[model samples]
Target: MLFLTIYPKLHVVFALVSTHMADEDATTTKLRDRSHIDNTLRLTTAEPTPEFSAALKKLQNIYHSAIKPLETAYKYNELRTHEVTDGEITSKPMVLFLGPWSVGKSSMINYLLGIHDTPQQLYTGAEPTTSEYTVVMHGEKSRTVEGIVMAADNSRSFSPLEKFGQGFLERLVGIEMPHKLLERVTLVDTPGIIENRKQQERGYPYSEVCQWFIDRADLIFLMFDPTKLDVGGELATLFKQMKGRESQIRIILNKADNLATQDLMRVYGALFWSMAPLINATEPPRVYVSSFWPSEYAADTNRQLFIQEEVSLLEDLNQVIENQLENKIAFIRQHAIRVRIHALLVDRYLHTYHEKLGWFSDPHEVFEDIVSDPDKFYIFKSILAKTNVSKFDLPDKEAYQDFFGINPPSGFKQLSSHCSWTSGCLIDNIEKVISVELPALLSSLGKKETPPPAKATPAPPPPLPETKPKNRWRKD
Candidate 1:
């Protein structure tokens, strides 16, 4: 409201005084400067008239009004004494471990999650302990006795994911952290894509959830029990649902602890060739052999040694999870890139104005310049309307491909180029998007903000206040 009141009162200088000194091409150059705007509409900064004096005074006062409060707010936030600890998602991901009912999904999850008593049967029985999606977030480790809402009907019912997203995106943007994999990548444990027959016949309640998630999932760790590794039927159908898209889709050979040494080799080879027709896997899925239930022989182990090495996983703590962080960081780096692009011209035009205007000059003059180019301002508004801040996701594979047409790289160079993709790409993208929108912004400014050229009768300057010449040597 304040900006609106002040903007019209100020003037857009055509700098007529400098025209006589400029070269012959000055007229052509000034006219050709429309590269920034396809249609250049000139509004002569007419010589000051009687009414101009009051408007100039009010416009100058607008600058006077804006400075102090903005300065005070900046100082208050910068000098805070205590800083809170906020790096939860970066340390532990909100991993959602999901799979078929009997695939040892919870068993390996508990192992990786480090929730165990070490061989006295931590999970009394491991026959798919989690049938519904669950989100396990960061909490005090001492209390492995944490909160767990094991199952829910509505997919978006759980609120932890929402809060986690808010905190994670905020941290990622605030830190400008380089690690791109993910700081707030929530590990969502979803129901497995069951056999297509089950989806067709009984109509698995969550197949819709599965498809929706696959379309939006950051990474999918598909579990293929060793027994079914050689058979491509189930795997192929799941692959069909989420194929061609790039990033993370890992195949885990669960229940490898159930397979024999030679059979394990056979299943691995067979699954690779069998599924080659369906899933375009860069690498064969990650295969792990281990029981969700601890082995019988490990039952007699001493508590301290077992707890130190296996239960608490304290011995090789850093080494165990160090490699995974790289993947997670890559996801978040992408998010920062989008936020940076939110407005390209607004950032550049304002900065350029500030650089020229300098200190002691008002900053509102910079935005006033934006409103000055009502054409440009309209262009920016049109482009911004197309973009929604909520939709940019670096970690989720499908959004990159479908929403914005960016997909994960198949090779390490693809990763490297993307990781180092210029800070200016967002701006470049906006420039391209708004080229079509420039005329709109320009037309708007022309109507609401830009002024028409001077009229045929040039207006005379308003007279200054009159004062009688002081008598010589008069001092009060």
Candidate 2:
């Protein structure tokens, strides 16, 4: 009985070990394929404004000459250089439209673009007809770009969307039109937020993808109909993500024309009560109460208010072009911070790994020697097995191996040396660009005069000599 029980347990243990090994192999293969994909699917850069172009080139030069080589040398896996640089340096001002079905999102977009007669515009309907994320951009003529082609175009922001998997890719569409408004703004229409649990059953990571767009958007328009002003489930979660971005968000109370003046007030008040907690704002966000011109079935009795709101919205949208440079600079600054943090973390790990490996008596000397003979860098494996890393912190073993593995020893050493030297330079350059150079440039562009230097106050004259003693004797 002892032998039988022990044998069964041993078999189970063997099976688990085999399964783990198989999983590891699969992960390794996947990582390798991903690297290959990245290498082959390099995107073309987008055409940005002159100022943005110059700044972008500076950043690109820094990465290519500094960060890239260092990351390669240290065998760091969380490379985001492409994410920082791939799209146009000067991205167009983006206005993202989000709401539930029948909130008049598509109708508003069409009205803004003045596409009354065109069937080529966004498909507007009463039901939840838009099931995809549609990107509307400026073009010479109206046309639709398939998701796959859009993914292949490195110049577009949608290039990154490819990684969300085929299910998401299948649900994406790009519309390019010859609209004067699009020349200054890109409008993004997202899928209507469904309240049901069935949305969760969708294979794609919906919230994650939406968050990506939210972070990049210059402004967000949250639409709500008076009839359906609910903010629950996925919508609630999305609003929570907009915590710090409250200033850039505008609440739109659509279909106000359908309600009587008193009822509209009631609905508006109710919306404020419901959204105040969700938005968590000290002051309620600006709400544009208007109906899209084409949707006149529920015409507003208060035509003046509707016209004023529409005009104000358009003016706000136009202001984005004027502030484009500021937005781009801000983006670059944020990207720099991310890169700096990544470099510091990788540097720490490399130092620890070298120390553990007993590569040299001094940790600094280890990198120096490694630079001379990169082939010996494969010795990293010995330390990797012993290293403890959190899953959330960095890429896993397979990803690391795919990026840093399979190189000839000499090539590895050379890359290591190159990266070390470049990373040092990169860190310094990035600091200068973000902290010192960019500020002065921006100040000059804004045409604000620098404050005159304050004059130094002269030191008080030396105390009069012997006056104190003379006064004491006289007073007595």
Candidate 3:
């Protein structure tokens, strides 16, 4: 009897493991083949200003020809897997909405998309209704594209999101329509955060997916219903993850019509207090108090305030559209610097190992040596100092360790033979793109009368190009 019971349990476990492995294999096959039925070229349909388009195209050319090769050869792609595609740089500004269930995330999206009618574009309700990550974009006619098909397409920026696995892809969809606002900006609506759901319950990496969107988004709206002010579970985790990105976040006290003026004040105060620990910012994030749904304002006394707040929010969105090119350029410059640092650090790590163990030694031996010695960080510090790169620009320690821990460093070993800190021409090419090309691109984008307040500490403006510049970049 003991043998029989134990054998059955073992068989069940084996079956589950097999099913998981099979699921992974299927996901791998689907991605490798890129044979989704709707896998057609996804060209950008939204029309940006002609000048903006020309400048962005030029920057994209420079990036692919000059920066991408260095990033790929130095394994910077492995560190930050999201390759900057042309679509990503040229696409409309993305405004991402994230918040708890029944908080009006979808409703706000619909309101902005001008889909105010009986049948909403995205399902909305008091309970959890939106169960997918939806990207609403501009198109001639309204249509929905499946996530698997969208993810498989190289033209879209979402290919990087495929790493989240089939579970996330299935929950991702693109809703295209001929909306006026979408012509200027893209809106990403994420699934509502639930209070107590575990990662297994969700069946995907929720925070990681959110972080991916957060990192790329020009504006992030963290909407909240007046009824539920407590931030716990997934919502709290997200707030914590958004530490460095405080500038992008705009807190929305949605459905403010539900509260009277006195109650609204109390609720807003309470919400800020609850969030203070998580946000840890010097001041509370800008909270726009408004009810997004059409029906909410009809019966509410605070209709005027809501309208003013909504207008303010819309103006901010418009600013995002105006600043999109500059934002893209800013992001590209930051990414290039980070990639350069990543490449240089990887080169140094490998060179040190090559000197110690020579080419024949196991790569793991160097990784182990680094892991064993905490003092080895000083060596990296020295490299950063010499390069005038901040130590903070380095990749996350855990991620760096995991990469070197799992992957054989033979490729890096080969890279070290030719790509040392001082000798590599690729470094010079990348720097030229940074110091010369990008700033020139920025200048070509004629100065806006009053540019929006920068989302982060502004990158120091690149220095003027040298008179006798090295012809490091490709002529074309």
Candidate 4:
């Protein structure tokens, strides 16, 4: 009996040891992979155009000096920080290709990269071939990297995807190619949407991952072929999520050369009819019909259609680089609006708290009383503590002091001046940065005029003096 117990315990210990060894090995591999990816990113990152570089710098300055300070003050740091980083505005435009498996997504990519004559840079087949999301970017030499490397590269923007679970981590692939086209655009090819119930049960957060990409992609190509014209299941869900991004989405009807004119029209009609409800748009998305690569079965008429469609798609993609600054400005403007609203609420709270305490009646007397006995202001602190500010939207208390021009009381003069200055400066900064300057910059870049910002109402006039006698008990 003693021997049996000892043997089982020994076995358990050995199993634990083996698992630890495996974990260590995995960690070591991930570190090595991360180093390799970082080096590759350094080599592949292209220099931004002068116009884009200048715009990015101006935006970064505004973010760090104005927006970031306000957000840090109100504790709203979590709001849209991912969209603009020091380097994000200058990074290359991302183009994402989303579609069902074997819909010629990869083949079209190969053709664009001029790798069609060489061994396929991306795996293509009639059945599902790509089992991972592949990100192809410019490099001096061709290389393949794993997802961990992407997470490790701080210069790249994919770190957020790491939270999608290990399944997603395991299924991400990064391809570095020397194609000239990649210098202007970063292309992402996702694993075709899985329709099988059993496959979907594998716990990959497909829709969530796709939504992340959609949020960052400057242009999204939703590819379809004759074989899979109807969108359903996960694909339909993905389309529904893309409702507001219609301007960024382009529907590509691929492999049209395989059908005759009559058959092609039927397929086109079928696709449009089926996708109408799924897209849920005022007008149908632009559908670019093309046979991206030469097909042995393609007819002369099909070839003509492919040429026209391919030219249009390429032209649209080329315009993305020029529009990068415009996109960044738009992103910043949206976030700025949110910050302004948050500041407004914080200012309102401060104003109300002061009014309730009757501090506005005789500011000098109130300041003297509070300074003489700091403990007497416990109600003010308590009110702030009890306020139901959302954790995500909370502003910094110190920021409120700065906005209101309240310096820590060195003497009586500073204390008395508190609440004397209105929050007009904060409001003015928001309007100037987001409304006036941003719109002017956009127009200078020859981009369309952004809608004018809603005019901010000035802070309510300070409360009128009360004739009632003061309550002395509240004052220490």
Candidate 5:
């Protein structure tokens, strides 16, 4: 038997014991049990400090007091922007996994979280196994919630997905597990991308749905199979849509064990060359080569490299947890800026319409014309130039077309005459949040919270004394 104890500044002792048996199986079981207990203790004992909790509360208050109202009054929700919800404010950091079929997206989730007592909540196979998007989160017990129910549930942040239509909602699901790591981060497993599949075949706007998740995800892993380095078809479209999100993306060349060390180098180079035209960044995104699932690569020469890369990736995930609060505030700040721009443009459109034609002119026709040829519209051009905002900063024209296309013309008429930006304090409040409130809150957080020190790569533990093998064991 072995006992380990750790003591902190107060001299309080936390002790754990592991019993060894002559049977190797029993010893392994004991080790696994000890690891599970250690993880639980760490999760339970490490409560957020009072200062951090208070900071979060203040962040929420800033959103409710300043940002949310601007969005509501300006009808930001009617625009391309996603409406922020309370569930998103309180949710954990989200990590999104994206790749083509059989690229091991689901397997990677299992590897990171299902190693302990949690059975694999996701299905994995050589073919397209995951047909729907699954959100793996923490809860008291294991259960599955259908997409319709999940989106309807006010406690979850999935309500925005409802806009994707009934076809998409039918394919979404939520899986809950009482796992230790999930308490720190949420994992989203997306349906694998298939080559030559048309958007019409999917019964929804696939690229648009992906863009929505991409905008909200804290980190995105673009997994690739070495055998399928060709980024043709939908994958190319997906990569192009990820423009300006280079910092959040990490490319993973999964299933590297299948190739020899030299082959891996050639495959990696090929992968980079293929991704160059699609990725809009000047520098290539970080690429990690490894097989995520538990498997033996004893004969492979890149085993050591795989171990190091895995550690680096795991560290990145830990960093996400540490910076969760900061990321949320930053997201809100950016959203506020976008809403401000949208409000200004809408106000400009309405004011121009009121000026050109007298009070009772058909505002709906004016709005339609503006949406159709925003670039040629003298008012839009003047507004962009005067405000020093780029044409790219404007909301998606297609999104506006679709929304107004389905709804009545009455909505556009209402929006045109209301002119929230000029009629109320919405613009002033949002500007204050973007300039003063958000910065002050972020500065206070920096003073209250100290970042954890960089973790050094741990030296490998000494190998167990040589003994005849009693049984073949797989790593958990």
Candidate 6:
């Protein structure tokens, strides 16, 4: 300690345990202790000279000797066990209704679905509302609740997951008929990520939970009561993690029924500009304040007039919804393209795995490892450019015959034979998407649909270099 203190140049070491590390036997224990000591030494010791650094490196080897039997592990498990994803799973994309508590996440959900139903047997007001992560799936088969359930609404501790249930919120409802807008997507009603003393006590910000959803979400409508929008820090994290992460995560400046029009414009302008940097927008950030609230005291004295404003706002809302829908479809299409590219990628480098790679675990584990590597996308992009694929545009239908098989089923053959078909589909889903599904969705977000961009044909590649006889090939 004294040597470290006296010589600013010295390198010293120390060790600390990682509660998250999975392999902690005598070997892992020793390695972690060594890591702490090494970091301590690096912090101390007489100014780290080339010789001291080498000595420190040797000490690390001794500390982790126990892991030698596990030939594949490089170090701790936290760095290794976590999943990195570049594609969607079978799960439907999540649509979260997020905001500070009492800003009406539940009410908005009800309004969006146009329902008055709540949990069963409990008075509508008594049942838990949006106190946990409530997932709504269809309920055509002898369901209990007409559509909503508030049976369980509690926070789950997250230092590590508690026994699946003890502290977590549970979903109690099966969705019935829904607001037309929800027809194509799964709706996730997240427990308020703020002011739940129980959640914050568990050592994670509610914001992180919200972020996890945004990270996977194909469409996100982030609600905000203008009053709390100024709250800082977490918004930055939210923006950093989600800004343009998906084009559909739009800010729903909710309860616009609260602000004066002139004041609303002034404040919203400032707030939008402030958050603009967090989103990947070349234009200023876009937001829609809803005077959708029936009351008058809040902002947007114009909301009660939603009836009067219906014709105009409806037209406007349709355009917005279309834009958001386009973004959502585009995000999913891009994800599909990535999976195709990754399939091509693994095929190109299958030899690196050990000779006896287990069919069940090896493919997934290797896929996880490769995707987690930060450079994975860069490599994937290079491969995609070579393969002639684009996330925004599907490859030509001809590209799929060898992929899907030279002889597909009759149904698929019909699809493939379309002169304009691509990747086994009738046509690129997104192009038709703009004219169909997107109009309603973007209308909800206040974006107008411009005509889709005209498709272009690629020019043929330059003729290949002419070959010459080897004996006479030299240029004069």
TM-score per model over all chains: 0.37, 0.68, 0.79, 0.65, 0.79, 0.45
* Per-residue lDDT of model 2, residues 390-455, tens digit only: 224343334333433343223333213332443455556555655766566566446533223324
Model 6 misplaced regions, further than 4 Å: 1-95, 116-129, 136-138, 141-186, 195-212, 215-218, 294-300, 303-332, 352-385, 389-476
Model 5, 4-50: lDDT tens per residue?
Answer: 22434223222111111211232133221122222322433445678
List, residue by residue over 1-476, the lDDT tens digit for candidate 3: 68658799786667557744643443234111111101111112223546766787888888886788787787676766556765687677899999988788987776565474535367766557788999998889888989988888778878778889999999999988876677777899988888888877777888888888998999999998876775887788998878878878899999787678999999998898788878877766778898775443445466556655665566566556667788888899888888777777677666666567757777677667864452465546755686447767766656667667655566664433444555466777788888889988888776434323334443332232334222111121
State the displacement of the C-alpha of residue 141, model 4, in Å, after optimal TM-score superposition.
2.8
The digit string of per-residue lDDT tens for model 4 on 216-277 reads 88899999888456576877788887977888898888877657788888898999888887
> How many collisions between residues are there in candidate 1?
24
**Per-residue error at 165 for model 2, in Å?**
0.7
TM-score of 5: 0.79
Candidate 1 per-residue C-alpha lDDT over 1-476 given as tens digits, one digit per residue, 9 for 90 to 100: 57645664442122222322331232234110111110111112322233333332332232223221222222211212111111321234333344555465555444443343433112323233443454434332222211222111122223222223332222111111211122223345554435544544422334444554464444565666666443435555667767643334555555554556578778878766776777665755433333332322133333222222231211112222222333323332222233323223234333444455767776566545544453444534443455543333212322222312221111112111222244323334333323433223223322332234645544332221244322221122
Against the unseen true structure, what C-alpha lDDT does each candidate score?
0.36, 0.62, 0.71, 0.64, 0.71, 0.40
RMSD of each: 35.2, 22.1, 15.2, 20.4, 13.1, 26.8
lDDT-wise, the better of 2 and 4 is 4
Error of 5 at 303 (Å): 2.3
Residue 55's lDDT within candidate 5 is 77
TM-score of 3: 0.79
Question: Between the candidate structures 1 and 6, which one is better when assessed by TM-score?
Answer: 6
- The stretch of ten residues in a row with the least summed lDDT in candidate 3 is 34-43
